[model samples]
Target chain A: MAQDSAEAANQRRTTARRELIETQIHEHAARLFAQRGFAGTSLGDIAESVGITRQALYYYVKSKDEILAKLVADLTSSVVTRTREIRADTTLGHAERLRRIAYLTVMDRARDRTRFQLLDRSASALPPELADAFLEGRRLALAELRGVIEDGITAGEFRPLDARVGALSVLGMCNWVAWWYEPGPDHPAEPIAEQMSDCAVAMLRSEPTGTDPLAALATARASLDQLERQLRIDNRRG
Target chain B: MAQDSAEAANQRRTTARRELIETQIHEHAARLFAQRGFAGTSLGDIAESVGITRQALYYYVKSKDEILAKLVADLTSSVVTRTREIRADTTLGHAERLRRIAYLTVMDRARDRTRFQLLDRSASALPPELADAFLEGRRLALAELRGVIEDGITAGEFRPLDARVGALSVLGMCNWVAWWYEPGPDHPAEPIAEQMSDCAVAMLRSEPTGTDPLAALATARASLDQLERQLRIDNRRG
Candidate 1:
């Protein structure tokens, strides 16, 4: 039993080491790809940047295309996973869920801004299968966002609007952060994410007058009651 | 006099024809670049696609880079022009101006979706001067957008928020149409533009409760007046 356990622990260490190296390779590759066009970048350039031999780089990735595919897959899968989690959370209101999803997306894009920028510049050049996978992932996330918006509208948490457009607008607002957001003291990711998420929720919020007729009436009644009390005090003074 | 007039009219016709052919070249080059990418495309390929000889293509554009530079210039200049006009229009309220600007941006992006997609994929590869010009134009438009949002907040038409973030969110919402919008009967540009513009306005609109304290107070006063009248009537009946 001791021998078997030792072997398993050794295998786990090896696997972790491999993953760490692969991640380093991906990071170096993405930075190089962002600075130099993917076509202009080569496996040797990435390997050199990662301080590995060209042959050693082959142990982690097959080709430059594989690195790009992996980057895109990582981005898309994370989006899908995060959005799916938000979509399935029953404890949160639709508006709150949407806000959380937008916040997470903006944060993710900001964190991986370089990779996102590389993808933006090279997505069209991706091979058919890779491109399809990336696009499918995006479509899944978009659908999940739209579903939340639809639920919000039905539950009267959001204004009645085309859910698809609303989802796209929110997605666009968050995704565009990849293009423009610079992580600096002046523009931290947290506050920018918060602002973007708030804007997304604001886009779908129902107006106060139309959100709930009963609520509006009650508010008016309460205001009138207070005003009447003040008027009586003024009458006594007169 | 007759000969001079004929020469002037002939010069006008030549200029018009040259302009028409140049537009065609740009359209074909943009489509090819979008499909094959900037690096994959060649001047010969663009010329052949435009049904012109390489030499003739040179007459229309000095090089492929020139064509790309013109495309970027056209897009950026149009954005700067339209937003600047909207910024200066004193007749429209800030919200209306913002809506109009968003609407026009969406419409413009939809119209040039192909070129915009090409630019998105290849902008990083642009030579420094061209890229600088494009970025400067974008910055100008963004500043105009931010200015409008600032004015709206000052005027109490919009919520007090980071105008820069608000402007970027709106800009992103509209620019994203270039990536996803398809011209079809089901998704006409006009309606989509309207939806996007309305969303932009919604993002910045002040809540009714806070938009105008005086207006809220007036509403309360009107409700109190109605309630007092009803009470008097009930007292008379008793």
Candidate 2:
């Protein structure tokens, strides 16, 4: 009976340890994929990253394709869900909504650049069906963003523009944060997000209905000056 | 004496053929690097693409690093030279210069994506000294671009803004063309360059001064409409 009890406890411990190791595998895979790219990274590389044998990795993941599919799918769904939540928040004005979306996109990228890198740089590694699904999710998010821009134009809150090109340009700017941003305590996501949000606003800024053009340019210039000052302060604090 | 003359002619022919093969090797290597990434591609892969043995490839390129370095350096010099030429053109105004620079950057990328891909995406794979040189070239190009923006603001052609951010953003937009653009005769670089230049203007547009803000927005809107129409026409022609 004592032997039986010990066996049960041992089995439970093994399962828990397996779960922990799998999580580590996922994280290490993400980091490697982000740095080296998906195609360049091998299961051997991932196994070495986790200090495990290839056989052990196989117990958790059948192939790199499986891991990539899961990572990309999860990222797609989360971005879509968060974007929907932002869209549902009707209390915000059109420009504010666009601002928040831009801020949140940058914040998400800064928080987990690995996921963004995988989705942006390695989604092509996924199997066709999985890639299609992930792309659909991304397409939906883009449509939502384009919808907001269209609404803004209708309300004369934004200058006239091609919604598709504008949406893509916004995403391009935000996605690049994943490529360059390195988070620090002093240089937190809030300030970067704020600056990016302002950039989005300026990017979509309409011609002034009543305000002077020079004055409008001056406002943009002042915001840029403020942003640079904030960046300096953050750098000093760091 | 007759035998010696024939030998010399044969030697000249061999040298010419060697140069041609080396150029082919470089082109094939670049295509592979752009498609499969620098790390994922091997000398064997490039050799196969060029229909040669790996041993033959080594006759032209010592390693993949050497090939990438050459491609990147050549591309960097070309871009820097072109940008300087555009800047020195005194006949054009500030906004026109910015527009031409934007168009030329995109046109250059579209003309030979392989070079841009090597410089932008695979410069990390270059040896340290080569990588530093390429980066310095990029820095000079960006500084020239920023200088133009500063001049524009000073001349009151462009609205006041952070020249650094504006320059980076412009580059980001132009660089992305390398990733997505598929070159064709019908969809030439000229129209795309025009649209992108207009987009750059719209992005930096200041508030209305003496001109009606609504009219400015209307003009921006008209340009976008024109761009879309041109795209459709291109698609039909293609």
Candidate 3:
């Protein structure tokens, strides 16, 4: 029994060390990939940056290919997993669930900005099968969001619009967080996430009856005309 | 007078030929940059792809640096210029102007997907000053969009929300077209732009005075509860 416990403890240490090494490699590689284009960055560069020998680096990752693939796979699976968790919560309403999903996507992308940027810009560098999987993963995420929008429409919680278009718009809005978000002492991720959630929900909500956009424009135009006329009259009086 | 006319005609021909060559070089270079990345692609590769000697290529463009700069500058100027035009039109209401700006952004991005992709992915490759300029141009464009949103709110044409957030959300929704849009015989830029414009407008329109998002959710919950109660009563009766 003591021998078995010792073996289990050894296994745990190995796993923990593996995790630490993988993370260090990824962070270093991502910085290199960002500074130099992915094509310009090499495994040797990553190893040198990580302060490890190439052979030691090989123990953590077989190639630069594996690191990117792992990064993209983790990004995809985490999105899928988190989205499912939000979906499985029966207590939340459809709109609230959507808000959470939108917020989560923006937050996740913001927190892992470098990883997502690599995923976006360097996706072409991935191997053929890996590229295909990455695309499929994105397609699945978009489809999931579309399904939620459709459900909300059916539930009378959302306006009836093209679900595909809505999903794309929402995803685009959230995905852009990776491009411009920066963490600062004064600015926190929570507020940005909440703001995005509100905007997304605003986009999907059903239009109130009797509020035609064109009609609203017409009203605004008429009001502008009246204001202009009144200003002309005042100018004449002066 | 005859000599001057001849000189003018010769200048026109030279300009036209230069334009043609520049277009060819840009198209080929953009493809290489997209496929192999900016750092991976070299000027010699571009010249070979363009079927021109490297020296001849220099006559059209000083370097690849100039090509990318021209592309980014053109993109920024076009967006800034177009947004200004939309803003200048007094006949169109605020929402209509906003819609056109949104539509134009998406359409422009969709039509020039390759150039836009290069601009986005190769941004880091630009000289530091160039990168700063590029970011500033983007900031100006977003601020212009935000100004329009603020005008709409002041005019009482849109619901009051954080204009900065609204602008970012709209721009994000439109910028994403570069990532996924593919032009085809059946899929035109117009419809996609229109759909996105509609979505953006939908996101900004004033909610009906009587409708509250949270209140709506509460009502939905109550209705669900009533349905469950009715089902229970029917089951007991049976």
Candidate 4:
């Protein structure tokens, strides 16, 4: 039993070391690909950046294409999974859910701006299977967002508009952050995420027709009371 | 005099021919670059697509970068010029102007979807000077759009919000068309442009509070009139 436990501990340490090297490979590859166009980058450059031989790099990733595919898959799957969770949350109102989804997406893109930009600029250079997988992930995310918007419209929390267009508009607003957001003292992620999510919600809000019906009724009742008092005084004066 | 006229006509024909070939080169280059990424394409490929030898193609463009720079310059200048014109249009209300600008942008992206997509996917591959020029044009366009939103707020036609965020949101909605818009019989451009523009306008509209003041006053007066009649009857009975 003692020998078996020691072997298990040794195995765990080896696994952790491998995982760390793989992560380093991914990071170096992403930086190189973002600096040079994907087509311009090579496995050798990534290996050199990560302080490994080209042969050693292959132990972590099969090819440059594999690195790109893994990076995109990681990015897309996380986003799609979170979006699905947001869509499935029944406790939240549709408007609030939509706002959270928008916030989540903007922050996701902002946090991974470099990877997102690299993907945006190099998607066509990806292998066909990898490209298809990335696109499928995007479609799935869009469907989840569309489902949320449709629910909002059905619940009358959102204005009646094409849910697909609404989804795309919200996605666009969030995704464009990847292109323009630069992390700095003046432009932090949370505030920009908040503002963008608010804008997305604003775009979908149903125009209030003469205010809420209850509020309108209350105002009307108050005016009637005041007018009645004035009329009573006038009648007495007469 | 006859010889001089003939020589002038010959010169004009030569110039026209040169312009035609240059246009063909650009179109073929855009298609190839869009299909294969910028870094993946070559001058020889563009020359072959245009039915010219690489040596002959060099007469028109000094390098592949020049071709890309020209295409981007053409696209950006036209958009910047149109945006500036819309911004300066004093007769139109701010809301209308903003709607028109949004419509124009979406339609512009739709019309040149191929080139726009190419630019999006290959911007980082552009030479530094060309990239700077493109970025400058983009900034100019954003500034013009933001100015319109700011004017709308000042004129009380739009709600007070961050004009920069509003402008980017509208731009994101329109620019994203380049990514997803596929022209077909079922999906027409004009209607999509119209809907997006309306959504942009809706996003900026000041929420109506109990309807317009004139309408609210009219309602109150009508209520007062009815109350006065009812009171008269009550007073007589009493």
Candidate 5:
């Protein structure tokens, strides 16, 4: 009876320990991946950073690529889930849903910028299976954008342009922020999110009635200036 | 006199051989770098691909970074030279200059995509000195766009948007094409260029005549559909 109890306790401990190791590995891998890139970093380096033997790492996870797959998998799944949910909301006009998605995407990235950064850069290093998974996730997201474009057209709220290119333009504008974005010290996420959403929405509107391009552009310029200044000023002083 | 003639001939042959080796190194490096990123690719692999010893490759170029830098330097110089010559014309509006630059960028990419591809991916690998050099070249080209935008705003030809952000928007819409653009089998360059120029002009028009939101939305949807079908059916088939 005592042996049976001990075995149960041991199994529970192993599962808990495995989970802890995974969480730590993920955290360290993200930091390292962003610092040196996926290809530049090795399994051994990750193991060292995690304070474990290489053999111990192998016991917990199969390879570095698996760790990357896990890191990005949540993001991909979230995007698709959000896109599908947004698309199914038939009551909202296409433009309205698209605007919501845009606003939400900016906010999402604002909350967790590191995930976006890793997903963008490490996409090339994904093996075939994970690559397909990632690509499917991307295609679903892009398709959602196109659906919004189509809905907007059917609803008569936007101009006619190639949906794919328009989608690309909107996404290109958004995804680039991962590389250059910084939250304004003076303002918070709300204002930045509004401006980014407005930029996407304004670009969609066939008419520029009362549009304010300078507002967002000024904000973007100031934010970029802060980033460049930080590199020179903060890096040395800190 | 005969000895002097032989010396000049031999000098020309040596120069020709050096140029040939340099070209070979760049070609191999670009292919390898694209397949396995800049950080992932090593000098040994590059030399092996070129069928030369590591010492011989070094004799031609000082280091791997040198190969990356030269690729961008040549392209950067070309872009600046082209932009400066156009800016000197002094007879075009912001729209026309934008058209010219967009077309030139596209045409240049089409003619020698390999060089520009290297520049696009490897610019971040540059050392501080090389980074400064390459950035100055980018800034020079961007400044030409800035000039056109500033002039447009001053002359009341464009709405009062921040010229810098607007400049990037227009350039971003154009340069991002390098990421996914393929000269489609059905649509050749000239017609597509003309249409793209029209799109850019339409984007910047200072005035907007209010149209029904619903109709505008429908038009946008149609365009997006066309674009989706237009994107290469297989982005990874290559």
Candidate 6:
């Protein structure tokens, strides 16, 4: 009976090891895929970069698509969990609570930099259904931000602006942390979060600004709209 | 001789036709690639989506990489040029000038939804050299912002936080327009720019802050020490 119990324990250990390996494969693939893009990279290249054989990689993930799917899935899952956690934390004020959630996003993304890179970099190739699901994770986060802004505005803590756009403006700064927040050179996340909290809160408190951008936009629009209106123009000069 | 001039004119027309086709491919491909992703898409798929045969697609651009390359090149070129022009404008106050520049960035990204998506979705896959060059455009734009913040601090128009970090927070929000700034329901480009400008300026104007996250850092250190001691004792118990 003791021997049988030991055998069962060993089998469990083996299964756990397999799962760890699979997890690493996905992480490695995601890192490579994000850096090089999908078409620009190959399976052998991903395996080689991970210091594993092509066959060993196969033991973990069946193919590149599976790796891509897993990368985005993992990100969406974490975002959903974090979003819910912040939404449910009733003890904190809306501003403080929103700040905490935003900080969590940056910290979480930092720990899983490769996956963030993949989700940001390689997510363009995902099919429509998958893309929508991934984007909805973003939408949920945006909705929570909107809720916090609405709470603050209604409470008179925040100046009244269009809450949806305002929320996006605040959230966008935090989300873009994945793009530029390198751990080595930038000030630590704690202080940076403090700064962001100030900025977001400031955004909440301020009035509207005025600046027009039509001249610059006209350049691109001229080209884009010309195509739209090409056949309708008088092409002949008599 | 008039017919010869007409023939030369015909050559100019043909060249413009080719440029338009190139522009067409860039537009369609950037939109599709940003939505789909590089790996999840195919040359055949892009051609089909463009309403052209694979052969016709080849005549316009050699490969998908060429398409990606063009999008990045085009976007960075325009971004850099506009940023330079904004920086060069001499008559405005540093803060107002910064606001106009920020307005340029927010509006520019808002106009080309595809390039905006590409900034979020495609930059990761760029080869290291190209990616750095592409990013440098943004970095230059940001340098312009940093100058404004530093000048504001010098002129007593802003608070005395780390100017660089403050600038990063501002640019982070501005860069995010691509993901969130849709045109119908909430706020359009002009209003959105104003709201963002308020946040950016307010972030600079607000006095130090109330939460004082530096206090949290010390508390974190104490809690970490406690956890370490508890973990050591638990391991000895086993």
Highest TM-score among the candidates is held by which one?
1
Instruction: List the DockQ of the predictions in order.
Output: 0.21, 0.11, 0.19, 0.16, 0.07, 0.19
lDDT at position A67, candidate 6: 75
The model with the greater lDDT, 1 or 2, is 1
lDDT (CA) for every model shown?
0.83, 0.75, 0.79, 0.82, 0.68, 0.69
| Complex DockQ, candidate 2 | 0.11
Model 3: DockQ against the native?
0.19
Tens-digit lDDT track of model 1 for A78-102: 7788888888899998889998999
Model 1 gets an lDDT of 0.83
Using TM-score, rank the candidates from best to worst.
Answer: 1, 4, 3, 2, 6, 5
Clashing pairs in 3: none
Tens digits of per-residue lDDT for model 5, A1-238: 9999999999999999889998888878887887787788888998999999998899888988788889778778888788779878988877677778877876776655776766665576667787788878888888888878777866658654556766766665555545445767753666545655655666665533223444334434554564476457646856
Q: Give each prediction's root-mean-square deviation over alpha carbons.
A: 10.8, 12.4, 12.0, 12.9, 14.2, 15.6
**Candidate 2: tens digits of C-alpha lDDT, residues A125-167:** 7678877988898889888898888888788787556666567
Q: Candidate 4 lDDT, tens digit per residue, B1-238?
A: 9999999999999999999999889888988988886888999999999999999998999988888988999878888898888888998989889989999888988877888877765665777888788878889989989999999999888988888988988898889988888887667777668768877887787765565665455445534543554355444435
Candidate 5 ranges beyond 4 A from true positions: A1-28, A39-67, A88-91, A106-114, A154-156, A184-196, A202-238, B1-28, B36-67, B84-90, B106-117, B182-199, B209-238
Worst 10 residues of 3 chain A by lDDT: A222-231
Off by over 4 Å in 3: A1-25, A37-66, A88-90, A210-238, B1-25, B36-65, B127-129, B210-238
Candidate rank order under DockQ? 1, 3, 6, 4, 2, 5
Q: Please identify model 1 stretches exceeding 4 Å from their true place.
A: A1-21, A36-44, A52-69, A210-238, B1-19, B36-44, B52-66, B210-238
Q: Decide which is better by TM-score, 2 or 3.
A: 3
lDDT for position A80 in model 1? 88
- Candidate 3 residue-wise lDDT at B101: 96
Q: Say which docking band candidate 4 falls in.
A: incorrect
Give the CA lDDT, 0 to 100, for residue B206 in model 4.
Answer: 74
Q: Report the CAPRI category for model 2.
A: incorrect
lDDT-wise, the better of 2 and 3 is 3
